[model samples]
Target: MPQMSPLSWLILFMVFTLSYLGFLTMNYFSTFYSSKTPSQININSTSHSWKW
Candidate 1:
């Protein structure tokens, strides 16, 4: 097994932190723009009863 050096660990941590921050920022903006209308509809059909 290979072990990462201190500098490598630091760099990996920074990259992960930045990526997480970017994801959070995107989610924040999405939430902000997610609700503009008041009405929503969802339809689900689970039965097949048709007359021919």
Candidate 2:
């Protein structure tokens, strides 16, 4: 088999690294992010299912 050059190896590593980072970034943001703020949540709401 033929040996790979340093430049070729560097390019390959960069491509793979960038692609992997991009994949992880995509997965990190794949979840549903809510835009609700503190004011949107009701403090006195009786939505709790537990009783004291």
For all candidates in order, the CA lDDT equals 0.80, 0.89
Backbone clashes for every candidate come to 0, 0
TM-score of every candidate = 0.52, 0.54
Q: Could you give candidate 2's per-residue lDDT for residues 11-32 as a string of tens digits?
A: 9999999999999999999978
Q: Which stretches of candidate 2 lie over 4 Å from their true place?
A: 1-4, 33-52
How good is model 1 by TM-score? Answer: 0.52
Query: Which one wins on TM-score?
Result: 2
Error of 1 at 48 (Å): 39
1-52, model 1: which lDDT tens digit per residue?
2475877889999999999999999998787455544346445658999999
Model 2 C-alpha RMSD to native: 4.6
RMSDs, each prediction?
Answer: 6.5, 4.6
